[model samples]
Target chain A: MQSPTRAKKKTKATSMDIAHRAGVSQATVSRVLRGSPLVNAETRRRVEEAVKELNYKVDRHASSLRTQRSGTLALLLFEDPTPDDSHINPFFLSMLGSITRACARHGHDLLVSFQQLSDDWHADYEDSMKADGLILLGYGDYLAYESKLAHLVAQGTHFVRWGPVLQGQPGISIGCDNAEGGALAGRHLVAQGRKKVAFLGDASTHFPEFFARYCGCDAALREVGLRMNPALQVDADSTEQAGYEAAQVLIARGLPFDAIFAASDLIALGAMHALKEAGLRIPEDVAVVGFDGTPMARFSNPPLSTVVQDTSKAGELLVDTLLQLVRDQPAQSITMAPTLQVRASSGG
Target chain B: MQSPTRAKKKTKATSMDIAHRAGVSQATVSRVLRGSPLVNAETRRRVEEAVKELNYKVDRHASSLRTQRSGTLALLLFEDPTPDDSHINPFFLSMLGSITRACARHGHDLLVSFQQLSDDWHADYEDSMKADGLILLGYGDYLAYESKLAHLVAQGTHFVRWGPVLQGQPGISIGCDNAEGGALAGRHLVAQGRKKVAFLGDASTHFPEFFARYCGCDAALREVGLRMNPALQVDADSTEQAGYEAAQVLIARGLPFDAIFAASDLIALGAMHALKEAGLRIPEDVAVVGFDGTPMARFSNPPLSTVVQDTSKAGELLVDTLLQLVRDQPAQSITMAPTLQVRASSGG
Candidate 1:
């Protein structure tokens, strides 16, 4: 058998060739190639078989020029505060899967890369016609990253970000209702008869997602005729070690806190470790709740109660929104609803 | 600030233009653009500045035609037995991070996609010149996937996979010393006075990695004058749920086991969950050990004891091997040494 690599050196196969082999009209072959629903299943199968036999590839560059569309999207993952060199947060990795599937569904290839905030990274992918638009995920310190978003905006780079849907933000964003997620955790803890709830995450304007979650938790406290104690709030980056240290700090302060609301599951896992080490029984002494229903939450010592961000919806919306921007359509920011998953740690 | 997207409509700046602006020869600019290390830091910086100023791209298609290189590598992740729709194993995800970094270091853009086993998936990417070569990870049931590997080899696809290094394997592969890792776990468990050991995972030729691990465990047992009881072996796929079910099946068989060795960390976690649910204490009633030292292992209820595959080295090796193939260099299979990370579950 001739090596396919060597075989490719010959004249490339075209859709017309596939159509001739499949005994179908060129138009039918085109419909199958475009993944048009108008094509019958048997015909599509025949065309696909013909394509496989001939090893035909649609010339992406030629098609891109003709349609003024690259048929590719770039997923730029900004470096996050990770405990290790991986830099990717587990939550974003989950989102990556969804986004990849969503892109596949929409017949687009994805170009993934790590984005450093310091570099002139924004001037490459889309500007070079490598990708039609960009989907941004996990920007550490939104306040610092906001200027870069404005820079992208001024450059007319079609893009969408997965973050807190703040009014007047520089670009279209698709995010979970972080405030509602926080409120869910807060309400659950409060109903469990926990008076003092500690928030363990960077809760400031600089970190809009965490800040929104904090606000929601605060609102829940207010609803119960209680208020979040300023001293109970410990600012920590989204990491297990940071969460562990934050929990230790909270413990050191001699504050009477019976519950904790971590902005992320990683933080909650670390806090749980610290609480266990400190000889505090979960739920009996302190109830804990976390956000982002990562897989780790399901397998934690006592399953973690967390706010489940609908990653499937988020992925579809991100791709849809970015595609709209690529088409010069007016795109708007969308906030997805969050669901609270009550597990053993939350005394459910 | 003109939108970069809009500005892209103008003729792209050329290397000659950058050379003129930087007061260097076009060859020097080309060397800098190609990421040749021969260029001095000052000269490279000057050329980079000129590039930024003129918004220059090396015209990938033109360069590709001249060099027969796309300057891109495709990282194809095969679907694994995942508990959720994500279909990604955490261990491979870590490798993905390392591979991405390696590609960037080599001045190659990485195009990542999930591969389904049953498809003409191999006909695209490198065949279309979208990527220069491929780095494959995760193939569930190697026996079934072996034909595909052979097909890839027959087609002369320049690719490398992460799997067990065995004789007659179709292509160059980079894998961990699974047998050695299993022996390490076995020796540790034996030292802790465990006699009857249960092995969770398919221990057969169909799954070479797990089979190798089981073989090593058998060797360790032989050294201790104890033979592995065939009845104690339970077949399980890579997922946690599979592990959980495997553990349950082992328990139901009424086997007298003092230790359990899982093929992967996910399986170990699931087995641990099952054992705990059955009211058994880890490292007391039964010592449990797993392979693949993922981040989750560090935070598992009783930090999991397992074998740590050097993902960094694996990534570097896989990319280097694939590049060697792309350059028509003879590539050899490599097996990285695995280190045993003895944690709480192993009574370390």
Candidate 2:
């Protein structure tokens, strides 16, 4: 099975060489490589060994052309540039890592791209036939890109999105229970005997995930016969810089708030930075809580208290669901539960 | 140039339709799409307009069937499983981000995968012709994988590695000045009036990057009539858990070290955690510095001081160099400089 020296002698091995090495006919080698049921088990194994030893690729283009299945998945990440220059939100990077691993586990390849919000990426990916299906991951306005998703659905493209699993969405999705995550943060803060909580993130319909989180926090606050102050809430994107700026704006409003819940971990980190710069101590002054339990959250200055979205599970499900759609299996939208990680920042 | 509605009316558009829309013969459209110099700029623009508006892919597999180039790049990230299960080093994730962007800038698609160190990934990518070239990124024993690089070279596989730019390596590489990075950490600690500086990472040829960093730091210490104590160095991988365990070992050794320099940011982060757990105050009890100016360092407890490698430039160089090789252009192994980011962790 392992013949490194043989592979080196020939720059590119043809099917004839594979057939010769396997002690089989070229037709048998083709049958084995093409996953035909006509080939016997022992003969298929032998042909595969020969293919490996000879470093033969079986002309992926020709194979894909015949089957119309490229055995590849395209991951189109809508670029959300941050001040840190990572170009991808750290939370999304973790997702990307998991998704890549899951693809390997499922025996598929992944084609990754950082796309602008305005690109006609959905149609292009399907039309190009570069992949069997698509996995959409990013941070941006849901409304802004919803039309593109509708277009994808209209054209019958197989795609799964990573965001809030909303009703009437054009495509299938795998998402965290943002409301449950926010409620957990709020209830934790509420149990700490805190009131007048401020939220940092856009709570508009454009960003439904953040909006759901806002509503969930409000519901938790309502449990204590209280409601989130509209004036205390400042709209911010899912970025540290935006979180910092939103915090500054909240501070400038001269409103008294005891606890702050950021829509995402990055926003929480930035808000914490601003709070510290303004001489506000963590937990004692403002009990700060963030979303997304990324590794970065665990190592923050006060070990940020965050709503840990199950990214590992999310990645697996995203791949699984997309593959289901690709194989014409009945795949449905999935929503995973979120949990709270109490740490120093939230008075743990 | 853009016509979304018409594209939706038809599920798939053909070359004949593009020719008709461009007001040219199918031959002219084919020449223009194939990028033959025989087609003029105005005709090319008109045909391209038709292609985009109609959302015709031109069948990537069929096109590559005629021409050898796949117009795709494969990024094989050797999985370095961290305790957090992200499966990729955060530093490498940054490089991945930049590399993905660079591929987009260069008009090439990117195929990403998490490969095991022992897998025949190098040969598979080349043999499959799934990508025009390969970009290999990961962290492990250099000697363990050096033979694999040699195998790739022997097979005339087009590849660029991300690691130490050794003078006589089998394939081309784009790397950071690791020794200089180590020197930066040593000099900074020295400037803080620290005499005893410990190092965390493997200091052997097996891990050339870490070994070079160890050597660089030792060299810097020697300039001030001092040398790194052999007892103070601990062997560890580039993971937070590894760092933590290494630091615990160092603490148990009772080596009177006043400072510590980790080989990577993950190690520093883990070491910092262990140090804090053992009732040691950062910068005061033991000044600590790390390499890899990842964003995680910027938000860590006491804001970890770290050596910064120019990953964006490295990404650009890796892609540019690989494309050069793919195009039969001259490519060379390039080394980039490193800088230090001073933070409170190192008493900055």
Candidate 3:
């Protein structure tokens, strides 16, 4: 093998080199080399010709690997054993875009795997020899997968997980400032004189996300001189339909809530739709706020006022943190603060 | 080398063998083997012990190659160089989610590579002996990466792309019916008594997606006893801000238009915001219909009426198509039809 210094010197084709030959924005040149579709065809052709003529070979992957990366990150999503994949929320889509972009910026690629709770495909898994790190998403009794993940950690694989890390498992976990977000919602509703505010969450479990959000709401209610209304707290599956059904059930029980705070944007949208069908004017008859600054929030009817966590930043930071850990660098569990984006539904 | 059959049948506890030993999904076994975080710790332990006891010697580099597979698919995204991974349209996200789901269901992983119009990251690409197939999404200009892709095809790599098959490109192209989506948008706006409708699309000189959408809208208008008033055709750079500005320009020109058909959900959402801020009521004031059944469409203020394409099917079809091509089977282009999802935005 060549000396490390010699290899590094020989492989240097800096961004400046490509820019000089391509005669475009260094950013444009980077985009060209990154194979982004943002540029024009004419520009791409010129850049390619320049690259071929200059013989500029950029070992993005090797460098990433040397920096303790296999130059790849894995996104492990829990697969539900069902035929219909329609129930999937768009949050994954948004998160994926951010994660993919972050990987590209660092000159790394993303590898994704899905874990379905089935038996026939096990024969296909003996080939697990790629990737330097991982970012785990998805849910549904992933205890078995978490155990294997723990083993990988024991074997020194660099990884970071969002949501809950397996009980006391060693890994970096990043999540939204759920407590703050919940408090923001609670305060906003109370400020609008909504004494009878209701809390709706997607899951019944005491996952950190749900618990934090719930706690924040409780704290906010306490601060605002209100009592925690247990009867107003409802558990709904995090879906638009579920939100609608939950709201319907509450209405049927003769609940008189002036405002509703749902944990997710999808659930909020569904609640809004149900409220509309029942001839209720948004913010006039009842106000609503949702968490998850999903793109859907911006476009929701009356637009949803919700907590917008910086997903792109989160994705970028997650990858960066994992990369640093891979390089034997110290890392911390990162939590991003959620911003309250006030919209029509939230009395903006 | 030993006879191919002998090599394949050599005694090694394959994933299937281990899966048979432990009653679980094949995908789960692959997940555990890959150290996915979606499995339970107990199941992972069982699989790990099985591997150790059975002496499963999995050759990382050779497994995918030996089976003529990387057990992974490549996702080629055409992206613009944006600070925050430019506002990804719902269509792309929907397609990506479906693709990811399909790869998961079929016991395969996904390798995502973003190819911009002006740059080429062929360094890592050259070494990515991984990935048995490629799924091209949001690739605007085929010429940028088509040749390299062609070279790979000639070298007997199996891949499938979305959208039109490039002239002389050897691969499968599975795409949503752009023409149909355009027609549906046009028809919806027209049916709502909106006469002077304008078409907003992304920049088309570089990539063909916008152009295809434009052609489809034109065809629909022509069928409905109308023609694009040339002056009403607007092109923005495919950002919310751009869409907002385009609507302003159109409004400033006082183009005789009572409707607007934006090519993407993002563009449509921007246009809606711009129109609303300018005191235009949705549907009642100027009906709007967007293409791409993004989740945002369902949540948009007044709920956007748009065209929904089956992205999951597209992903699955791409994989199946590539596998067939790898087997030297004849595969044809698949065009998926878009269904019109009526919502409040279209005044439905």
Candidate 4:
């Protein structure tokens, strides 16, 4: 006599259900589902497992459409400042890779546009589609783009400036602890018992990276009761050839610095070439240390000692910071610690 | 007043208009727009110019939807390979770069997947999506996921294979003319009166590259009236360390090779390093030539003489070929010509 009709079981888990299960807000559950790093990994993994078990499928496009948002991000890189060897600062390269990977894991993709200072420049085609956010790389002279970014921000566009931000701009940035890295390098050299030390840097300004390294080195030397030998500190053209010439000039002047700190690994490697050619033994005759530990640092004849920036993590952080801004959340400016990888040349 | 109505304006330009302007057929216009190489360069350029001038946007997404096809292409690369340095094969790197660029230019983005053979793993995401086509990097005998590819193909997913096809399937391949490159090296050495010529390469089977190069060298040596020297040939692991060790082995054997041709640039560069360490005079005692012509080729000391393959062009071609296959159109295999870049290392 009982009716055969039984309640149909629920088909799939929804965001609210996942949220309740994970003991987090629905927004946090959504963020976890979207692979946004704003949520801690433990929470995210739990949410993801729940999603898989529940066989939940979120219609991202529909939600984004309702909000009139494209759910897409644009990566704008300055093609003009591309170094001579097309050696994009490993920092940017690693950052781009991380950002792209992060975006992909979140079921989104980046529309990349490279702009150069050359003639025939135009706004990126995707500009009309209006991306949800932007990851700006080396967009020098933020003043020129201030109105552009301000307009987007007013329109609810979220973005993170991956490179240095201009003063007075309401934005977020993630960069390396350049000053600390510099200080680490300086202290390493000073600790090696080099009473006389020189600083060789590339021709760069405005980039917090170079300056931070310089300042760190400066402070460390001051703490160690030593100052940069004015006669020995020089700015090279930032090429291997330039480093060679700088070393040659230093050697020619008979500057008796027992140690040197170069701003870039390329320059340090180049300086090493020059020093070796001049019959000077590395670390023994003149201890040399470089910043930005590239793969080349290890393979060098005696190996190079340098400060390493976690480029991939920097990239991930840059994207994470940008996404936070996109979601109308606050983002703290972050500076990553530099890793000291000591090799033969740095007397480690 | 009754005749005041204006004729309805055309909403879009048809393929006919593009073909007419480009002096080709509607079919040709479609092919050109799809990046088919069958169209002559001038014709393709005309069609492209017309498409740009008209601001014609090919809604590839909508078209894929209409055709009930997945518009995405899969680019499968080894996540990691032995002699990790081999990953720097400029040819493959260039091809990857080109394919990515081409896909973007054509309003498509590649779904890149890493296949590590040791894991015997398959990509479930790509398989479920049934990618429109695949552009695979020819490396090792990683087991093939044929059932997956077959399933997609059965579902009307047209596909194009790059590099050598597996099991002699009717696959289209685009690669550098390695044999020709090899012959060029052989002839150059013979012309310089090198009686003994050594060939350094990696694995024999996976190295279709080495085979191609060897073919060219064999031809060149025959033309130069020189016999092959089996004693001078060595197949080493393709790594800097391997090259270094191979060089030592070659020298210890006291084989009189006046010239050497390494299968890849890394091998050549490594060999050069070892030779330099051994105090052998380059070009005088052992002129060296390298294959693949990676960008690093130009930067090597003595500026390594190499056969340069235009990686960007290769990238463009790979995309073009894949698009053709995606459209259910006939695709042709292509060989990119490798040009000999004469540098000091080969004594040229």
Best by lDDT: 2
Tens-digit lDDT string for candidate 3 (A313-338) = 88888888878865666777766788
> What TM-score do all the candidates reach, one by one?
0.88, 0.94, 0.78, 0.63
Better candidate number, 1 or 3, judged by DockQ: 1
The DockQ score of candidate 3 comes to: 0.21
**Residue-wise C-alpha lDDT for candidate 4, range A1-348, written one tens digit per residue:** 111122232333568877877778899987876668798988888888777666555643334434545556677666544454334444344455556656765655565545553422222322333355677765343445556555444434455666443344444566667788888988888888877877776424534556667878878989967776678777764456667778888888986889888877777878988998999998899998887766556556567898987666766787777677656556676757888889889777
Name the DockQ score for candidate 1.
0.32
Better of 2 and 4 by lDDT: 2
- Per-residue lDDT tens digits for candidate 2, residues B1-348, read 111121122446778999999999998988987789988899999999999888787777777766867899999988644346664688989899999889999999999988778786867876777888899999887888989999887887888899988867788888998999889888888889999999999999988999999999999999998889989999999998899999999999997999999999999999999999999999999999999898899999999999998888888999998998887666788778999999999999
Better of 1 and 3 by lDDT: 1
User: lDDT score, residue B132, model 3?
Assistant: 53
Which tens-of-lDDT digit does each residue in A185-303 have in candidate 1? 88998899889999999988999899999999999989989978879999988888889999999999998999999999999999998999999999789899999998788867778
Best by DockQ: 2
Give the 10-residue window scoring lowest on summed lDDT in candidate 4 chain B.
Answer: B1-10
Instruction: Show where candidate 1 strays beyond 4 Å.
Output: A1-54, A59-68, A80-83, B1-51, B80-83
**For candidate 2, lDDT tens digit of each residue in A43-121?**
9999999887776887778777667778999999886443354546888888999998899999998999988887868
Q: Model 2: what TM-score?
A: 0.94
**Model 2 residue A207 lDDT?**
89
Worst 10 residues of 1 chain B by lDDT: B1-10
* Candidate 3 stretches greater than 4 Å from native: A1-69, A79-84, A116-127, A140-157, A164-170, A202-205, B1-57, B62-69, B81-83, B121-127, B139-158, B165-171, B202-207
Per-residue lDDT of B234 in model 3: 78
Model 3's chain B yields a TM-score of: 0.77
- lDDT value, residue B311 of candidate 3: 71
